[model samples]
Target: MTRTRGWLAAVVDIVLIVAFALIGRSSHAEAASPIGLWTTAYPFLAGWAVGWLVVRGWARPMRLWPTGVVVWVATVAIGMLLRVLTGQGDVAGDPLPLSFVIVATISLAVFLLGWRAVVRLVAARSGRRGRGRV
Candidate 1:
């Protein structure tokens, strides 16, 4: 997929993540700060990054599953670390909730799976061309 497409997916994922976070916060009466949003968003961004990396041929798409998972885990962990450092949120034993994990997993899977199909479709629709006098 093109960078534009990757960004589009990332933005969409971010929006979805934000929506989910808002709902979760409202339901749980948790303080939803900017740091919370960022922490929530990192995994979505990571998924898109992995998708872009795969499209660019830097990594195998199948391998991207683990990469995306690792990225999501790392982003969430690091975000929580930053939150603790900044004193934005307490270092509760459970940094994130089950919903966050579920949402991130779904987001990563959708973006990674959808990206390849979209790229292939775009390429096929654009039609292949050959050089002359090869």
Candidate 2:
């Protein structure tokens, strides 16, 4: 069950990251091509992978403390770094403006951490109900 949950968490993270890129692209009226989406998403996905390794997320993938927080930080930090390094910023010749960084940080935080919070809350409520029943 844990192994399955770990994989599920990883998949959910990936999906959310891609969705972040997709939404950003759409909002900016950029071409919604697969290549563009992949270009935008891969850096954050790589950061997420790094976070999983750092946290050994498979052990407790659903934990909001170390796992989710580390993943969220890493995804934003590393993702922004990569975007700047690769010249993929919102504007040409100005890789990684302050506004873009701020927006990306907040947006990715919401995307990466929001669902885990919801899941944790739901699970807690369900567990409480089960305990009361027994």
Candidate 3:
């Protein structure tokens, strides 16, 4: 991938976060307005930014193990921490509920890391095929 496509990866991460928020809101039957979606998205967005820093994502936006995993983990960790602090997290009977943590971790992992992994695989196969042709 070229340097220009790095921005596309960033955009994808942000869009995925927004989509996650939209789907979550829909699942809960919450109001799906721009403001509401933004509110739901901001905490995780902040975390996503931190994940970028933590993983130095611009350097390797599509690296799956450290780059993708670090981003995914940081997005959930920092996002959940911020959410709990701000009282926007999905808390039920308990303050730091296990169900909420487990669900968020798994969902965020899949959404945040899955796309990059797919891209990495495709890029690898494309490279191999191109080499074989010449």
Q: How do the predictions measure up, each by TM-score?
A: 0.42, 0.94, 0.90
Model 2 misplaced stretches (Cα beyond 4 Å)? 90-92
Tens-digit per-residue lDDT, 13-124, candidate 3: 8999899989988888999999999988888899989988877888888878787888888888888888878777546645567876797788888887889888888989
Q: Each prediction's Cα lDDT score?
A: 0.51, 0.89, 0.83
* Residues 9-126, model 2: lDDT tens digits: 9999899999999998899898889999999899989888898899999899889889999999988888888887887875766778888888888988887788989999999999
Q: What would the per-residue lDDT of candidate 1 be over residues 4-121, giving only the tens digit for each residue?
A: 5545544554565466556656666877888866665554455445544545423433233554344444445554455445454333665555655565456544554455456566
TM-score of predicted structure 3: 0.90
Candidate 1 wrongly placed segments (more than 4 Å) = 30-67, 91-134
Clashes of each: 0, 0, 0
Candidate 2 yields a Cα-based lDDT of 0.89
Q: Which residue window of length 10 is worst by lDDT in model 2?
A: 87-96
Quick one: best lDDT, which candidate?
Answer: 2
Better of 1 and 3 by lDDT: 3
As for model 3, its CA RMSD to the true structure in angstroms is 1.7
Clashing pairs in 1: none
